[model samples]
Target: MEQVPGGPERQSSTSGLPSCYRHPGVETGISCTRCERPICPQCMVSASVGFHCPECVRGGSGSGHSASASRPRTVAGGSVAADPRLITKILIGINLAVFIAVQVVGNRLLDDLALVGRWPPAPFPATQGVAEGEWYRLLTSVFLHQQFWHIGFNMLSLWWIGAPLEAALGRARYIALYLLSGLAGSALTYLVASPTQASLGASGAVFGLLGATAVLLRRLNYDMRPVIALLVINLIFTFTFSGIAWQAHIGGLVAGIAIAIAMIHAPRERRVLVQYGACALVLVATVGMVVARTAMLT
Candidate 1:
């Protein structure tokens, strides 16, 4: 029998699974996005699009140098940043600023920004809502919170879940995911919630981050118990609590899981296309839902 170079005999197992290049006995479904070499979770360094083996990440010395070794990327194919949590910090700052503005300006700012399917209730003129073309509210409401405890809890969750996600997905992708998740939440609320009832808060986006964290951890083959417990508890709380917009929680979570799956599992061959395309699709769905709900309300 002739030995083949860089062939099945060197990289695959008799069980029909590809063996990790560095650990021949270990089978892995993941491969280095740069080199396409099988890599177990232990050897799977997160790349901008997928996982990478240690060799590709380290690059070669002299004439064998590789691009990745010079400019490393995140699991979503985004350039690695010096401060991994920079995006998270910016997001928290924006939320805090809005919270402060609301506190200073009072219900006027809140009324102007809150997600209301309809405004002024039944007896008054229906002047404010997504139905009235107040589309900015879908996004603005995501950062609006009236209570200290609400903003406090939300910002804490944002730091806890979003910082790691930013490091994994990069600034651009992380912010996109956060915004889309928030929009999805608002769209769902508009679609199903009472037209006169108003909703505002960052919980929708925070829940989205929580869902993304769970997906990322699962992809890395990490212990799932902790995230699962947290998700279950939050879901229970969302349903049991009064004045909570449960629709937003469910919508953002579903969107987060869908987007994260695309970001983590997209083939390296077409990573950018698949990842952004999935995001575009989610955005389209969100817009469609909002449009449909607006039409119904108006």
Candidate 2:
């Protein structure tokens, strides 16, 4: 083969010699780097070691590792991704879609999508916004935002926190933390909020993820001053803001911390079951609180 600057390799044909492996009709003076069989320039694949046949390149299993050199294999569910930030991007997309929807529907969207604490469940309070059985509000409310700035801030928080936290916790655990944190926030709201009020936004989940990130960073022995400072500022804002739901923030933070602790401290042998069980306990506690509150209201 002859070499040229910025051009396809050209092959010098030999009379009555072995032809290209891929194109038999085409005669050439090239050979497979490993098998040594005659080949055409078109079939030659450039490798760090040497030029190889297309078959060897695809199989990655020929002589001198020409065949065996392939891409790294990734496991099914863990650490198997070209881009680790996929879940974070998807979550941001969902949040943006929900925000647009809420704006399109106006007050009706707020009434239906936001979480409202319901009490005196008989005919559902006339003053209550959504119907009595709309339990999904506990989750959907986390994605609903009233104003452009509200969504812009919450989405920004989620974008920052979700990437790191998801990287540390893995997709499944990260999703669990997000959803349960939202539920914890909504449940705490149900326990403390008046039936006349409606609550919405992703602050609870964002705070929960921040708490988880802090814990993970601490576990890794990384300095947590930035995270700690952010937490303190958010806490101060929660308390100082007029309409902020400090209860939801506190509830989500506590629940996230609890779950993160359980997952981190769990033994390797029992980690999966223990992490899931810890999450179940949090959910159960939230449910029990809501039920108890309902009974008291009744």
Candidate 3:
């Protein structure tokens, strides 16, 4: 949503402390220089004059006149958000929560969620795999992780990479890029990996973010060497590591690059449609892969 500043003053809570405009439960004394709304540390963006809320930093003149009329847009033409990193933070929270659930519930949770092409050797009821119609695994596996180091590396990469991309592309576009990329990865794994081989983790989504970051940096005419080198190192790890799901990483990377190009390069006139249409196309392709794979497995 487009954040408009300088609206009629909002009321403070019963505690007499104004909450951060973005995060309403958190009380804060700090206020945005332009909008004058209370801002917590997370919502605070340092400006030339003083601290401003994310919305004020992104748009709005301090004078409060024509603020709505002059609202700024991100590089991709998405509205500037009140919290640039909100989606990224929430994603991290969800992954962490899922990881904790897996730990407490043990392998059963992993069994139910991880992507499996066929699952359960013959003689077992064909009741537990993607081919047998447990299609949610394609998306669910994107968040499933068993090892500490795996989730740690993935979440760290996600925060480092995803936050900026989220700000640049806006929440709607960024999330589509992430989830679709992950699904692309899962689809590829299902298409290629052993039917009974289970795979799960956020690496696919994180790789997608990494790929999107590379595209965004190139779009902004920023230095390419750093991201290129990072990609090289990660690719080496993907191929060299014994247990890594290279298919998912590579699949997600390709999809992310494709989606990012559409998001940032679509003609301004047809931007939203082109951007989201690209996502829909990717989704259809992934579903196609699942259908073909299911038919083969069945």
Candidate 4:
């Protein structure tokens, strides 16, 4: 088969002088904003600034590259759309799946995953609930829920808070803030709740998103009155409700604030590292708290 010297072996439907940088067979006039290399539509990612090839996008993310921050993100889902809010959707899905599994498996799944404040046997406690050496409950409990109303309310709040926050912070930071906040909540529950208490739900993570949005709003010079009102109302409800883990709510809010502080203030040159460092510190602190609590219990 004969080939075009600088282009495809077969004539491409795309009309352009140069072929895609990676796909020599596909002709395209579109060039990457960063590297200025020609790219076909399929090879290009839409960025805040302009179109970019996958390689340039990857290269731009770190190593002090400025252009990468605006790169259109393709996340875990199939296609990344404008305002995808992919992380938020994923979190909701996982929670809903676990909720359904609870109905099917008869709360058995929660036994292994829910946060329990005590180390040993507590009658009527979920059989596999957190005990000594079951450290993973600190994070896993965020997904377990028994009541339909409980999961529904939490998922609604997550949809409201997470969509915008995920869009604003992007997927990675948003996820970090959420999971770390959940860990902080679990650690606090371990420290403060009755030894027999068993807690489960995504409230901790949802509160984390609220706190992050509050911080972001404050940092951006937006009026914080609404956020304050929301927090106050939520706290009131937390106190009013029986069986609610207010400790988790408070812990998650504080952790979220701490993480968002680093995210909102991080310098563009070191944003990823600074944000990740802040999250790591939160995780470390939560672990330290857990260890101290365990020592006291033992």
Candidate 5:
């Protein structure tokens, strides 16, 4: 019934200190790295790299932190290590695995598993028609790729951009951007591509990552010209390259740019919500455009 003046009730056998030095009645077995004091679970605060004790946190030992951990020590570095961007790497792995399975296992299996587009099938059963079925493709087609090169390029880009972006934004926001961007890309493709032509890839979502990066860099007061140049070069290449889905690229770019702007410019705590809402609006607009265009075409 007696509470320690400043410590938690629970005592750590290792330290013999109450869980938290501040709340002696509360039990916190974790110790602070800076102060080396036992911390109650409630009082424990997470650093970018590790957990910190309440005293260390109050004294600001872990504030304004940069990643001191090396690559292998980074969150994705080891099996046991905690990387803030682990989800990004896992997503890349899954995509790569899918690509390998498709190439090695053959298109027959892929077709069976492929995300179907809105268009009805042409004379060929494998080539489904894209009449009204475009809505389904918005979500599914991102997982499907036309060739090894297609998936390979997208996955590589995802790894290059997704990891850092996820690290900066955190897992939930990164995943939201990716999915929304992919959907936006597909929706754009449906809007512009001939209903008779079926297309699939993750380019749109990857572009969204680029957009997110642009926003992040700007928020950090980094130069935007380099990013703009990179985007321009890629867009030019898309136009020149055969079989590249320019519509998807443009769609993703626009969506990503919009999301990034909302995220970077919005109030600090509201950035994530604004970014998410912007992407959702873009998707809805893209779908509406696709539907309207399809009706006009028919």
Candidate 6:
């Protein structure tokens, strides 16, 4: 609490003691420009930028103050901020791990891993004696990939699209969209594809991300023409490319678009209950359609 030089010393705001211990009796209305600590007039010195406390001005704490305090908050609403990179890393890790496990364990472990086909056949058919249930595939098929390239492309697209979309939508909302969209995509795929053929991959979920992006970009007042063009190009590729599951893609896209619309157009401050309820409704309707379609096929 030694005085530096300019005006009358003032008492510390925290300490009611008389005459700035730093600068006696010189009223320095100016507080520490760095820590906002009370600075006596004499102890307060003006730098090129602003007033600084003697300790800060001498200690050189001013330059780094903003930098340390500028870090973004990592948590909100009881959840940590979802880093897009983390999502991509997780997805890649899961897919790669599953792929390695599949190769190591062989197809014999299909039933154990719940990889059996559902009501509609997946890209890989269920082995003999394995139970076939639609609901099972809804979750299982997500981890099953037909080929290296199948998973490669899906994970790549997921990283590219999923990260940005997830970052914008938040972890919870993004996750909800991803899972629900995948299910929606599968439902549509089941509705349209032949029961004899099985399908699988995160393509539907990626497509959902695409749909979500298209909706989000529009919401953020960004130009969506490019996104539309991309969608068109991808759709065209789906039709032209052999073995591509266009039904799943379209299903995921539609589901994503619907979800995005609900998320973006709803009130500025969304009621989680309402948003989740709407999502549930869409999921129920999508599943109902799938069931109806499957029954018809039978």
lDDT tens per residue, model 6, 1-298: 0000113334543434344435455333446556665553234344433445545644544445532221221111112242435655776688678777877886544434322223224455444211344466655566666467777888878887886565555567777888888878777766666554456677788888899888866754555788899889988888887777787788888888888777655653454655677689878977796668756744
**Candidate 3 stretches greater than 4 Å from native:** 1-70, 123-125
Off by over 4 Å in 4: 1-83, 119-131
Model 4, residue 276: distance off in Å is 1.3
Task: List model 1 lDDT by residue over 1-298, tens digit each.
Answer: 0000112233777767788776688665677777777776445566555667656777742225474655566766677676878988988999899989988998889889888888767788899888888999889899888888888988999998898788778788898889989889988998988887788888888888889889988977656888999999999989887778899998899899889888877888898899999999999999999989888877
Quick one: RMSD of model 1?
11.5
Output the worst ten-in-a-row residue range by lDDT, candidate 2: 1-10
Score each candidate by Cα lDDT: 0.80, 0.68, 0.79, 0.72, 0.61, 0.61
Highest lDDT scorer: 1
Which tens-of-lDDT digit does each residue in 258-298 have in candidate 2? 88877655655666788899999999998886776566554
TM-score for all models, in order of appearance: 0.81, 0.71, 0.78, 0.71, 0.66, 0.65
Tell how far residue 98 is off in model 1, in angstroms: 0.8
**Regions of candidate 2 where Cα sits further than 4 Å from its true position:** 1-80, 119-131
User: How many collisions per candidate?
Assistant: 7, 5, 0, 1, 29, 10
All-Cα superposition RMSD per candidate? 11.5, 16.8, 11.1, 14.3, 15.2, 18.0
Model 4 per-residue lDDT at 286: 92
Worst 10 residues of 6 by lDDT: 69-78
Model with the higher TM-score, candidate 2 or 6: 2
The weakest ten consecutive residues by lDDT in model 1 span 1-10
In what order do the candidates fall by TM-score, top score first?
A: 1, 3, 4, 2, 5, 6
Name the candidate, 2 or 5, with the larger lDDT value.
2
Cα lDDT, model 6, residue 295: 66
lDDT of 5 by residue, 88-192 (tens): 777777677766676787766444443334334445543343344435656656766656666778778888888766655555656777887777787677666
